[model samples]
Target: MSIPAALRRRTPRGTPATGRGLRLPVSACVVAAVLLAVVLVPLLVPLDEQAVDMTNKLHAPSLAHPFGTDDVGRDVLLRCVYGLRVSLLVGVVAALTATVIGTAVGAAAGAVGGRTDRMVMRAVDVFSSVPHLLLGIFIVAMFRPGVWPVVISVGLTHWLSTARIVRAELLSLRSRDFVDAAVSGGASRWRVGVRHLLPGVLPQAGLAAVLMVPHAIWHESALSFLGLGLPTHRASLGNMIQDARGTLLAGDWWPTLFPGLFLIVPTLAIASLAGVWRERINPRRRSELML
Candidate 1:
């Protein structure tokens, strides 16, 4: 019999399994560093909003201001740290909101199948047909530009995929022998769903939530860039980039470049970690990739 690809060692059968070792650790380290920056930077380094030196404004990278100064002579490095904090907050909260909404809807639809399932799925399809970014823009447009509005926008627009994942997982769990046994033992639908089905799908749902963080961060950044997210006074990756357009055009690059790096690095690190989790959770999908 042919061994499954996912179970096979990366090298030959006799060799050490080395391919998976580096990625997970490196990604974890990067993510930890980002979280540390988000937590410690604000408390350790204070930024005085009113203290701007026009003579020192827009200085290129130097020993005094490592990441350089912005258009108003504020430290770019400090602002980038603040931006990461805001972006991380928005991403994590929005993802959790989406996960909760999706899990509830999906659990209901899967647990009470038949007409209810059909109706719920139809609703999902209708929502999914619209692009997430466009829908997010519309939702955010209804509220004042701020952190909460952006969070709500990203959460509402991003839950469709999670719902589908959860619904499918619950449906699969519903057909299992344990579920049928519970039903035969006079257990109520709600009891069986809560005790059995919910636990089975939690891992999948958790993975989906983890994967949503990067997308949520990017969404928040995009909205802020468009001036529909956090206000201009707030330190956000999108707001930073938006505020730096003139300087970038004027041939000074650090203002735009450093914030963009901060944004890109975390998203990539989170994505890598998510990939590792996906492979560990779903060996079949990983096997397919090895083919």
Candidate 2:
């Protein structure tokens, strides 16, 4: 039973072809759906932050209030939705800020080399020596407790790892045949770095960015929990849990439990997606996963 060449050429690599691209894994798909819901549902349903109903205070999960009410009687479910918004915003912004700083520093160090590289690497070492959380707390303490401070704190503290990754990647890429050809063809150092080296380094940097999101989220939560994140009146997962500390001993678990779950689930989902993306992007790992 010899197959015709045309049929063999048309056949898919790993599965029956239905003229569609490979589908995402079940876990990745589930995570993507959850993330989409978390980001979108809150926009569709508005809730009041200042509308306190003391009559419903400390209520447990029920049909009317699926996540129950907080001490001041704001709908816990709505607060959770709003909290998700703040967490996602902080995570996304912080990760982006870190990535930009890292990319610039790493690209410059790797491209310039010599004195620039040494100084940059030394700076990275100094930053890396400090514990990220402690550094974040100190930075927030120095400035006002708000969204930008937390974002800046997390961004400033977290870029060291990304810088190192990009620097290593660029160092390797700089010596490649194509880059050498571009240099030999009269392209300026800046052009070669931006056009060739930068693009080559972006994939690794992007993966680093994806991985940074969870860390940023956790950092934001930690800051918020310590009352140094968003304003106390603003809804945030960290502050929601902070509010529950006094009530936990009195058997009021829903207040803390729901927000904690909200925080953990999204972080896990994002991390899971990053893992899947990494596996898919790496040829060896993609092959292994397929097998």
Runs of candidate 2 with Cα error greater than 4 angstroms are: 1-42, 286-291
Q: Report the CA-based lDDT of candidate 2 relative to the real structure.
A: 0.85
TM-score of each candidate?
A: 0.89, 0.85
Q: Write the per-residue lDDT of candidate 1 for residues 1-291, one digit (tens) a residue.
A: 999997764643233446567778888999999999888876776765335778889999999999999988888888888888889999999999999999989988987899999999999999999999999999999999899999999999888999999999999988999998999999997899779988889989999999999999999999999999998887889999999999999999999999999999889999889978877778575575666
Could you tell me the TM-score of candidate 1? 0.89
Model 1's number of clashes is 0
RMSD of each: 3.9, 5.5
Per-residue C-alpha lDDT of model 2 across residues 1-291, encoded as one tens digit per residue: 998875554332454544223333544675676567677776776768557999999999999899999999988888887888788888999999999999889988987899999998998998899888988889999987789999999999888888999999999888889988998899998899789988878888999998999889988988999999999889999999999999999999999999999888778767767765775677675565565
Assess the local accuracy of residue 188 in candidate 1 as a C-alpha lDDT between 0 and 100: 92
Error of 2 at 206 (Å): 1.3
Which candidate wins on lDDT? 1
